[model samples]
Target: MTPSQIAAFCLQLPGAREDLKWGSNRVFSVAGNKMFAILDFLDEGRGGLAFKVDSDLFLGYVDRPGISPAPYLARAHWIALQRPYPMGAEELRAALTRSHQLVVARLPKRLRLGLLLDPA
Candidate 1:
């Protein structure tokens, strides 16, 4: 799918929000106050998109056309996936769910509880 299409897909998750951070070039989406995906191609070759992915499963995506280890965050458990992949929409949705889950897993217990209990 296209970049905008991918970005829109990422934002479809419940309570997802986007912002132009990292110099206002990339668009990042967060869930439960945790970032799950970021748009790195909005500018050009200077930036790359990153998603919260498990290190073990990360290797599977590394060699994909536009996929790679996210810059500094890669070592901290992040992967950059280039848009327009041959991957199907179902696979993309699963990846997004995985990314969102990874971030949720890292949140503090109290914060996690709050997110679960708070309904607005």
Candidate 2:
């Protein structure tokens, strides 16, 4: 998916927001604190996307074409594109949504509740 489309999907999650980080890269985080995804535009129709993923499913993705363990974050169960991603847009969107939920789930119970009650 295009970066804009991916960003739009990420922002649809509760408490998700965008921030620029690591120079030109764009990051998506929950509750303005925990990051779930990152986008780096390489050229027209080509870019890198990375996100947290379930430990159980991590190996399966990494074995697939164009998927790899995310730099620095892979030890924590994150997956990244080995190149400008080559995959179904829907699958990426679903992964983005799941990544957002995973980050949200790890928030402190009180904080997660607060985010859910008032996502603004």
Candidate 3:
């Protein structure tokens, strides 16, 4: 997927919101404020989308072509999936869902429950 395609995919998630925190680089975060996707590739040359993932799962995608640990966030569980991959839109959407799920799982129970109850 191209940069715009990736951003669009991220936006398809429930209550997903975009913030251009890093200048014009759009960051896709959850309703509860957890970041699950970073659509920085649009303005940052050689940029890629970052998704939260477990180490083992991170390694799986990292070993694949067009995917790697995000530059600075690798140790903290972030993976960069480049465009032009063979993965389809549904697959990417599922990955983003999983990413959001992982983040939600790590938050406090109250916060997680609050997010679940949010209408957004």
Question: What are the Cα lDDT values of the candidates?
Answer: 0.66, 0.79, 0.72
Top of the candidates by TM-score: 2
RMSD of 2: 3.3
Ranking of candidates on lDDT, top first:
2, 3, 1
Residue range 35-75, candidate 1, lDDT tens digits: 77777644464434567788787777786766777776777
lDDT tens readout by residue for model 3, 1-120:
677777777777766788887666678887546788777644474545778886678778888887877887889778876656546778877887788777666667777566572323
Q: Which model is ahead, 2 or 3, in terms of TM-score?
A: 2
lDDT of 2 at 83: 47
Task: Give candidate 3's whole-model lDDT.
Answer: 0.72
Query: What shift in Å separates residue 117 of candidate 3 from its native position after superposition?
Result: 5.8
lDDT of 2 by residue, 30-97 (tens): 76668998887332234678899999999999999878888888998988783446678887878888
Superposed on all Cα atoms, the candidates' RMSDs to the truth, in angstroms, are 3.8, 3.3, 3.3
Which structure among the candidates has the greatest lDDT?
2
Candidate 1 Cα deviation (angstroms), residue 100: 0.5
- Which residue pairs collide, candidate 2? none
Better of 2 and 3 by lDDT: 2
TM-score each candidate. Answer: 0.74, 0.87, 0.78
Residue 66 of candidate 1: its Cα lDDT?
69
Residue 115 in model 3: lDDT: 59
lDDT of 3 at 29: 81
